[model samples]
Structures are given as structure tokens and as C-alpha cells.
Target: MSTPAAAAVSSADGVAWDLADLYAGPADPQLDADIARAGERATEFRNRYEGRVAELDAPAMRDALAELEDLSQLADRPLIFAHLLHAADSSDPANGALVARTAEANSQVRAGLLFFELEWLALPDDHTEPIITDPAAGRFAHFLRKGLAFRPHVLDRPVEEALEQKSNTGSRAFKRLFDEITSGLECDVELPSGPQRLNESATLALLHDHDREVRRAAARALTVTLRSNSKVLTYIFNVLLQDHNVDDQLRSRGHPMQARNLANEISQESVDALIDACAGANGMVQRYYRLKTRLLGLEKLYDYDRYAPLEQQDGRWSWDRCRQMVTDSYAAFDPRAGEVVEMFFEHSWIDAELRNGKRGGAFSAGGPADAHPYILCNYTDRARDVMTVAHELGHGIHQYLARDVGYLQSHTPLTMAETASVFGEMIVFYRLLEGSRDAGERLSLLAGKIEDSFATVFRQIVLTQFERAAHAARRSEGELSTERIGELWMDANAPMHGDVVELTPDYESWWSYIPHFIHTPFYTYAYSFGHLLVLALYATYRRQGPDFVPGYLEMLRRGGSASPRDLVAPLGVDLDDPRLWQRGLALIGDMIDEAEALAAGRD
Candidate 1:
């Protein structure tokens, strides 16, 4: 196990990430210069090889792929910069405008490069296989294979370019509008103490408050604020939904979600099985919520009390304590994992301040393949916030390990993307569990981990079903009113609760705020996929003991260099096995069983 190299770890004081490594700031003149240079490079490449990528021999093919990778990195550097800036402060018009410009610039460059993929895909297997399969192709094999997978649904080059160009002003614009409205929202929750003015992050943090009244106040605050903005958000969602429908239609896809399935490199059977497995286990969601209700002394759980904490003490976790807990947890798992996480702390790669206008939720976006990835989260030091750090850092560490694979191959499908993150979180949860000697604290720890699992597994899969229903409704019934969308949500989600909890009308527009539904249709399933994938992977880690660390690390090291099935086959796991998912779900059932035993003793 790689150990954390001896060094001075710093204070966990809340800090903004220093993007000086990427650029001085948004207005840095070099940004424009880089964009201009990238544009010139794109033109040069187009002029050199526009209708001719497939004609190149093995060595030339390697060079072309290498050159294309370099060109891509250059072209998107500004866009990444803009993306990070907007994530830090979505309410800023300057950042928003920069985002649009960068998107359009990226589209133009992509349009120029479309012919390369088109020609590559156009080649017969006999013509292209030798080059793609060559040992020298290295990581590029999987990249090319993935590119070719889209051959079945690819449009003509001109049409593809047209869609790319229109996206900046069309769907992309609507997404930005959604972001601005949400980021600008300020929820006023009247507490017993007084009125608390909350940003999205703070308001969300209150949902887990030990006090039921505070949780209710926060939930309603979010509902009222979002309901006020529903008209515009509703329209934006409709346009984006129709946009996806039109894209799928023009691509001649078999259904609304085939494009995403292809993009994820997952078969429809595997995805459907995963969804069905989770849906069938909806009773488990109810069971867990029922446990939560008994623990909280409630007759039943309202949607507001879904995340309410069992502990009544002020759980204001210090940022410093969070850092120590996560770092130590990673170290306990493997020094190597800790070492990678330490690099983020030492180099200032995290953005964790809870400033107004910052994007809600959290993410870890990889920078240029050679540079470190950046993490963005609006941290409020809640216990959940620590898990959020662990989660995002999992992504960071994964990106860090996979960096050597180069940009083109460093991108994992969303299904596998959550592997490191969820595992990282589990490491921390286990560490916390192991350290807890008191039964009450242990119960709290176990319940929190279980709830997190449900959020990832059952909750996300439910969200995916909601997406499917909403898409079907929009396509068959014409435009859906906001009320109609809420109905779709209730119909899809109510069953997951299975009478274990209550769903209020507020949850209707709740779907409206989920960025995934707006930005990436069918992306929700991956969380369910990833969560269960981690549990299965963690089981292997347990059976093999420390011996499993290398296999796990090697898996991360391989990154997107191989298919998901091929990637896990070496670990003695099968992505296609129906029993694999059931085993993972069974583990969750086991946890609940133990929790019940503990609760019985407590009484």
C-alpha cells in the first residue's frame, strides 16, 4: 500500500481553490490568446487532413491521434477555465457570458474536427482494425472503439456540425438560464432563534437538522422559492426535453435513451437489469425510512425529514476536522490513496467556500490531462459535507491516477465514474464506524451510511425512472404543464417510498431543480449503477483483504483504457451478472438487519 509521504499537512480552514495555475483570472489576456492559437491550430489540422484521416498508416495514425489530442487540449483549455469560473460563481453575468463564448468556440473547433471521427468511423473494420488494434495505439484503442460505437447513430458531418453550432444558443442557453435562477435563490427560513437567510447550500444543509421544525422550514423555503421560479424553469426544461427528443429523433435512435446507453458503453440489457433490480428493491427504501421514522420518534417521515439526523447535538463539523477524518480514512485504506488525496490539500486544488452565487451541490472536474483536477463544493461543515468531500475527492484521486492515460482516454463513462468517489466515501464511513465504541453513535453512523447508500442506489434509480416517464409524457402528450411534470414525478417516486414516508406537493417542482434531468438526460441511472458497483467492488476488497488494493489501484490506473466488462473481468467481477447487483442490495439489507438488532437492544 502506498503510504502518505511524510510532510506537513495544512489547516482545514475553508478556502477557495487557486486557479492561478490555469490562469490569473477570467480576464487574463492569455485566455484569449490561447483560444486564438487553438483556433489557428484547428484550422491548420483541418486543412492538413480534413477528408483524409483513414488514409494514414499505422504510425501516421498514431501521430494523428496524438496531434488531435494535443489540439483538443489546446482548444478546450479556455472552456475548462470558463467552466470552473462559472461553477465557482454562477450568478456573475461575466462568468455566464464567458461560458457562452467558450461553448461556441468549443463547438466551432469540434465542427472542424468532426470529419476525423466521421472518416475513422467510415473505415471498414479491415481497414481500421489493424491501426486501432496495434500495440502502439496503447490507450487510444478504447477511445477509438468508443468513437466507433456511435457509428450506428452518427449523422452526416454537416448536420453534426450544425447541431454543435446551434447548441450554444439553444439547449446550452437554457441550461445557463436554469443555473442562474437556482444560484441566485435565497431561502429565508424562520428558525426558533430568528429568520435565517440561506443560500442554496445552507438551506439544503438544514434539511438534516435534528429539529423537525427547522427541517420543515428549510424544505418549505426551498419549495416556495423554486415554485416562484417554476414558470421559467418549466419552460427551460420543456425546451431542453424537446431538444433531446429532436436530437434522438434525427440520430435515428431506437428510443429516447439509446444515445446515452451508447455513450456510456453499456448495453441496454445491463442498464435495464440494474434499474429493474433497484425498482424491485423499493421496499428496502421504505424499510430504511421506517427505521429512520422510529429513530426520530415520528409517526412517519415527511420528505423534509428524509435526511434528518438522529443526533440532536450541534453537528457543526470543523473544516479542519473534516480534512483530518478524510485523510486518515484514506490512509487507513492505503497510503497510496492518502498520498493522492494529500496532493490536493498541499497544492490547493479544492474549492470549498460557501459563497453566495456559487453553484450548489459538488463536483470534481478534471483539468488538462497533465494538470491536477479541481473540486468545487459549497461546504457548510455538516456531517454530510464531510462525505461530500470524500465523494468529490474520490473523483479527484481517480482523475489524478488516470491522468497518465492522456485526455482522450481519461474519461470514464458515468457508470464507472463514481467508483472512486463512492469507495472513498465508504472508506471514511467505515473509519467512522470502526472508531465508534458507543452503541448510539454506532447506530447513528450505520444509519447515516445506509441512508447515503439509499440516496445513491434507490433514490438515483428512482430519479432515472422519473426521467423516463417525463420524457415519454413530453413526447406523447405534447408540452407538459408544470403541474403535469409534478404528476409524472409523483407517479414515478411515490412507489419508492411505498408508504414508508410522505411526499408533499413541494416535491413536484423538486424535479425541476435537478441539474442532471436538464443537462444530461438518462444520466441519473449512473449514480445507482456506480453506488451498487462500489458495494460489489468493496465486497471484493473485503474478501481478498489488502491483496485487493493493487487490483483496485490498477483498475483506476487503467482508467478509460478498457471496456467496463473487460476492466472488471480481471477483478473476478462481472458487470452482466444479475446476481452481482442482488448481492450488493443484499448487503444493504444486512446492514439494516444489524441496525434493527441494535435498535432492539437499545429499546
Candidate 2:
């Protein structure tokens, strides 16, 4: 959820989630006991099932799968708690230690279960197909079919186990290092209020301030701070890049993106089309920015001014107002969607407090199947914060509906995961648009929506290109230095803005702040995937009206039980059609046109 600007700042103060429902703290004895229980179950399951997958009948296989799910639920409790703690404050050594310990324990547990997947991969289709096809297996059938997707990439059991074991001290360690480094950073910038120091999140919020000078200083503060730290961040990127490439090469993956496509259960062809279509539509983005240049009264829109608010709306939303706006919008869409939003607020399932050491960005994380999803966002009282509330609660509601499907099937792919969240934002956005009585408010709403669409749709696709180039360069050209990586970043970025906006060298280092490049290579495209998918789906909602509600709900409830193609096909979505993507991008273009029309009248 890391964006060009931080999602973790607020003009309005605080409300933190009560983790007591999961565990009071890392010190909770229940957390320790759950870890031990999961470990013991993992060992027993391994002893009973290892080397026996092919011999198991359909009934036995169902029981074995259920046992694995139980073990996963146990492991998730402490794992999620540790994650929440570290997210709340990455600088705390105790939180860091627990996160490390949780990773180690979860890895070991997963290692013990590794034999099941490897043996399943070894099973002939003739032997395995009938078992998964059985109606009694429920959603597990879809789960098994999806697991078979990695058949080409799965290694020998020992090799798979070794990778899992090494990942704790390897990839996981690097992620912790990244979190600590970024969270520990502070920006010193002069403001109208005089000299002020802020964390990455707060400092980034300044970039959106109405004052151009304040925005300029915030941008400079960010560039100078990140540039000074580039040496270390660059090293982190290099190691992470090499680590992924080596793993992919070992697995006989054809390209860096093959693994992601396979994991997403999507075909490579579909992904290729997506990247190409978005790149083609990048011209619309350039056109929109040219409009922005006039609105901002700038000869050229610099990177700092890219997200500058067109005009500030006076007043701020209180926390209660955020909750009410989001929940009411969801309810307006459907009572079922609203129920989940209510549950999150009523049950303390969100962490919206502004804190010094908390991480930047926003995300909705699901717990074990029976528990509620938890949202993490830094709520500033800006109008955008209202949209953020709607967006994440969309995810929270999705997780809630998907939960009863069981753990393995409940997790959606990266692309489908954004559907509910984006859709939720649309509901609130349209509500706001409808309620605005005057052109100025309408212009503000339209501008904000268009800006967000650019970030989620166009900008993310560009980052995907940057990631592709960086990974390829690292593989072929040896380790990439800060300068080289920055060059690759700018090379991918400059084309989208064309001559309308400037992509300076300072903005190059901005790439270092994105957690996605290190956390999940080739992951940025999912933002584009989900955004476009939802826009297309939302179009249908407008056309079909209430008829669309049931189909949409069914799609969310299906969760990861089916592949992205299967899940959306029932909703009449032809994902492979380039027209769908074009349609979505055109929606953004329409917004730009509207803004241009409004601006002309204002003159």
C-alpha cells in the first residue's frame, strides 16, 4: 500500500486497534502456547503423512487437508500478532525479535508440511484428479487444482524445505532491515509554522498541502534524506534482486515474472496484454498532466507537484465521520457489505492512530479463517482520508465474507484482492459526487478521483516496468548501483509524463521507498489489475443496477477458491479482452475531460 505519498499521516489525531481480541501483547502466554501447539501438530502430521500422499484415498486426503488447515490457523495467530506489533512500531527491538521468532517458527512448521505439496506434485493426474473432483471435498478441489499450478516450479522436498528454512534468516531478515531503516528516518523541513521534524509518513503528507512552498520543502526534504541513505538502500535492493533471480533460475522459471504469474494462477499471455495495454494508454496520462499544469499555474509539473491538491476544501473529517461515511456508503450498496464494515468498527478491528514509529502506507490483513480482518492506516482528517477509510473497509468486508471458505481457499490472488477495496472506494466517491451541490466541490471530488486513478492504474503499471528493467539489468549487468537503478527507474517513468511533467533525478531515489520491489517482485501490476477489473465491474453495476449486487457478492465470497479467470467469468468479465482495460483507462480519461471542462468554466 506504499504510494508516491505516504498513506500514514493525519491532520486529525488518534484511534489505535485493540489487539486484545487476538492477544494483549507478544507477552501473552496464549500466543506462546499456540505456537507450541502448532509445532507439535506439524511434527505429528509430517510423521503420519510424509511419503504417503499417493497412497491416501479421497476420504483420508480430506482429513489430511483439514489437519493442515488447523495447523495453519494455529501458526497464524502468533504470526499475525507479531506482524501487528512490528507494524505499530518497527523500531522496538522486542517487536523485531518476536517478528523474527514468529517467522522462524512459521517457516519450520511450513517446512514440515512441505512434503505434502511435493508429493502431491509427484502424484500422477490419474491418481489425484478423482480425489479433488469429489463434490464432498468442497472448495478444497479448487485449492488443489491451484496448487498443481506450481508443479513445474516445485523442487524436491529437501530442496523446498531448505529454501523455506533459509528464507527466515535470508529474505525475512532483509525485510526487517528495510522496515527498520525506513521507519527510523526523519525529515527536517521548514514550514510557515517554523522548523519542524517529521517521520516519513508525516513529511510526505506535507507534499499535498495547498502551499506550494510547503510542498517544495517537503519534496526537497524527502529527496535529500533518501539520497543520503541511498548507499544502504541500494545494497538492499541488489541483494534482494539477486536472491530472487537465483531462486527463479534454480526453479527453471522462464523469466522473472513466470513465478508470479504461476502463483497468481494466471496465464503469461494475459499479463503481457495487460502491461502492453496500459503502456499504450499512458498517453492519456500525459494528456491529464498537461491539464494539471494549467490548473497548478505551473509551466511544468515537477514530481513534487504531481499529487498537489488542485484546491483545498476547508474543514476536516473527524474519525467518527470517517467511519460513518464509509459504513453508510457500503450499506447503500448492499446491507451485507455494510455488515462487515460495521463489524470492523464495532469490534476494534482497525488501527487508525497516528504514531511516531509506525510504518508508512495502508493495508487490510486477514487473520485465521474464523477471525476478523484487521486494517492498518494512518488517518489524517483530509478528504482523501475518507476515501482511504472506504477503500480498506472494502478489503475488510471481502476478507470477512471469504473467511468461511476455509484458510487455503479464502486468500485471493493479488489481482482479485483489490476488487473489494477499490469498489468500496467507488461507492463512497460517487456518494460524495452526488451530494455536492456546487461545481467547486464537484471539481474537487473529480480531481481527487482522477488523481487516485492515475496512481493506482497508470503509475503502478509504470512501476511494474521499472521492476522488470531493474531485475533484468541486475541479472545481466551484475549488481546495479544507486545511480544505475535510479536511471532504470527514470527511464521507465519519463515516458508516461512525456513533456507535460518533469521526472527529475531526485525523483529517481523515490523508487527506493517502495516496499513492493523488495517484498514482491513484479507485484505492482496487481494494483493495475485490480483497479481495471473493478472499473469494468463497476460499469456493469451502473448498467445492470441491483442485478449486479448478487453476482458481485458471489464473486467476493468465492475468494481464492477459484482462479481469477474462473472467479470473474461467472460475473461476465472477459479478462483477456484488451477492450476491458481500455474501457477502464477511458473512465479515467473521462474524468480528466470533466476536470478540464470545469477548469475552463472557472476561468
Cα lDDT tens digits, model 1, 437-491, are 8888888888888989988998898888888888899999999999999999988
In model 1, which regions exceed 4 Å deviation? 1-14
Candidate 2's TM-score = 0.97
Candidate 1 lDDT at 140 equals 82
> Which tens-of-lDDT digit does each residue in 165-239 have in candidate 2?
999889778877988888777777777767677778778877778888898888888898899889999999999
Candidate 2 deviant stretches above 4 angstroms: 1-12
Q: What is the alpha-carbon lDDT of model 2 when measured against the actual structure?
A: 0.85
Clashing pairs in 2: 10-380
CA-lDDT, candidates in order: 0.85, 0.85
